[model samples]
Target: MSTLSLAGGPVSWGVDFADATGNPPYTEVLDGVASSGLRWVELGPVGYLPRDPGEARAALAARDLAAVGTFVFDDFHRPDAAGRVLDAVDAALDAIVETGGALLVLIDRPGEERAGTAGRATLAPRLPDADWARMIDLLRRSADRATARGVRPVVHPHAGGFIEFEDEVERLLAATERDELGLCLDTGHALYAGGDPAELVRRYGRRVEHLHLKDVAATVRTRELGFWEAIAAGIFCPVGDGLLDLDALRTALDETGYDGFATVEQDRRPGSAGDPAHDLRRSVTRLRAAGLG
Candidate 1:
């Protein structure tokens, strides 16, 4: 049997940025995660939780929840922004280490030009060769820092970013050594990018160190909205409530012997209506039913 572990994150509750306006208190988000029956979670945006390691650990422990990883979304393609991006990466690494987490999920912040062309792989602009090299070099440096700190760094190919397409993913994998970098396969983003999540699992195998189990609504393809707008339009739904084939993904994970944390994420606009705990519970129940829990 596969040894995949189930987890959740604050993004399901619309907490995208730590200092974003109108975010719920961190304690409330933790309560919601625990109430939904999740014992593991990802540390959502850097400052969303306590900055002090001890305080952050105590906060999660208080809820009977532990962090599995933290994410850093920055513009890595710009050579000028490399320093700032690494600083953000270091911050995320700090959260991971202090919270007893093992993974640092790296995402390229969505660029304005590509934001509206999220799922239109052919329409999205490709980065110049020089910029692409810069991005890869930045990722490698980030991975080196993460490994030195005893944390694993995984690159997440997110929608509306420079690295969202399968070809880009292929290039990235080709550029980086497997020992220094790994992949975080997100189901909704994979589908949104016109790639099969299960197929990706089978292809990547052990190189996929982490998972984000999300469902993309079928209606999403019909909309002409930007990435954030699509999120507000409910592009991402609870697992099994939309187009994700949970059974196939579970089979792929089993075949690959993937023993990693699969986090349930239903990204929403901040202050969006609907009870986060309720949606998360439904997702957890679906994952259990599909034999992924």
Candidate 2:
């Protein structure tokens, strides 16, 4: 197996792409990353790329950054649902292939309001058993398609998204039975949802396809904040500055023998000086020392 390594992503830094000379051009963003001492990057989406792959590849080549994964959303159970879930996945897959990305991250689930109000109105319990089964089946099929095209399907759990709770995570994991259908372990989201990311890593390390290295700020005042609000408020702080225990997470990963890209994630606004490269460099250094990189 390949040794674990560090990689940078564009989402967490809240990059100021608007100010760059090449507005909305991936080359500019990737060039900045290369200058920041990163060898790999998780490109946000192909939509950010130029019309031609030649241009995209040339840009990345200049930075020596490899495309690791792409963020994707889909409804595993409702393939034919009114929503554009499947169509979105198809389009994302096409883009993933174009960018040489091998992983598609799943970050969507049924909305709780759609399920019904059962007190808290969580989506997990509201989902009909049959629909749950269909969703799992859909995921399995999606996994097969991705595998056929040399891409893996990784389920990313979000704090406020449809399947944010721990129970919902368990249900989704139990419903699927394919090696291709894996988990994208997200630290801050798990913490926000009152779930232990390290424990999940220990329990499902074999299924861990990717990772979103996030840290949460838990305080007397912020502990009760909603998930989305926390994200929008720059809830994710630097690795050691937050509530997650990196030592525990590293221990779990070591025990499980898991190997994958561990990308830093923070959603703070970009400073006037420029991109948050200094903060990201600090995070990478700390993560490497902790043995996650």
Candidate 3:
């Protein structure tokens, strides 16, 4: 059976970006993560945590939490922005490595045009051939840099991003060497993009190096809301209370001999009412009951 370590992240507490308005203090988010029984965490956005390696390490250490990785959401399809994106990746890499993190989750940030049509694969515009090639090249370079630093770089196909669908994911995998870039399979995002998580595991197997455990509300799947609007409407629910089949996912992982960190991510907006810790604790309990924690 695969050994899965349960981790948490600041996104559960609505801290997507450092400068995102109304973001709760980092200390509060860490407190909530540790309080909810998670021992590992991803550094949310670069500046959301302290930039200094020592300080970042100290922060996690203070909460009795170890670093699993960090998420870098940037536009990789534009050659003009490649330098800035790479610099962001390096910044994230520096902090993650210093804090004992192994995975660097790379996500193509969603543009306004794609954001509204997220999960509508038929309606979403495809990247032009040159832009697609640029994205693949940047992914290769980013993965190489992360590998050089002894960190595993995993491409995360986010709901509203350029690489959210099965075909895009397959294309990316075909273009990059497996050793250089692995996959961060996010359960909710996979379903939201109209793919089955277990089937993806059966197909990709070991290429999926990391996991993000999230549950999408089935009722929200057919809604016409934008990404952020859907989130605001409670599109992501607690584990076991939504559409994901945790049992099948666990079985698939075991069958494939997959072992790694599976972080529970319940994306929410900052300043939303209700205790985020309560939601996290509920997810941890449900996952444990499902034999995933």
Note each model's CA RMSD in angstroms.
Answer: 1.0, 4.4, 1.1
Candidate 1 structure quality by residue, lDDT tens digits, 181-289: 9999999999888889999999888889999989999997568778998998889988888889988988998999898898999988779888888899999998998
Q: After best superposition, candidate 2 residue 76: deviation in angstroms?
A: 5.9
Clashes of 1: 0
Model 1 spans with C-alpha error above 4 angstroms: none
- Which candidate tops TM-score? 1
For residue 228, model 1's alpha carbon misses the true position, in angstroms, by 0.9
Query: What is the C-alpha local distance difference test score of each model?
Result: 0.89, 0.66, 0.90
Candidate 2 local lDDT, 33-58, one digit each (tens): 67667788876644665537777667
Q: Model 3, 1-293: lDDT tens per residue?
A: 88899999998888878899999889988998999889999889989988888888889898899999898888886679999999999998988888899999999987786888888999998899999999999988998899999999999999888999999999989988887889999999998898999899989988999999999999998898788888888888888888899899989998998889999989889987668889999999998988887
Model 3 lDDT on a 0 to 1 scale: 0.90
Error of 1 at 104 (Å): 0.5
Checking candidate 3 for backbone clashes, the offending pairs are none
Regions of model 2 farther than 4 Å from truth: 15-28, 74-83, 109-126, 220-223, 268-275
Model 2 scores worst on lDDT over the 10 consecutive residues at 114-123
Candidate 1 structure, TM-score to reference: 0.98
Clashes of each: 0, 2, 0
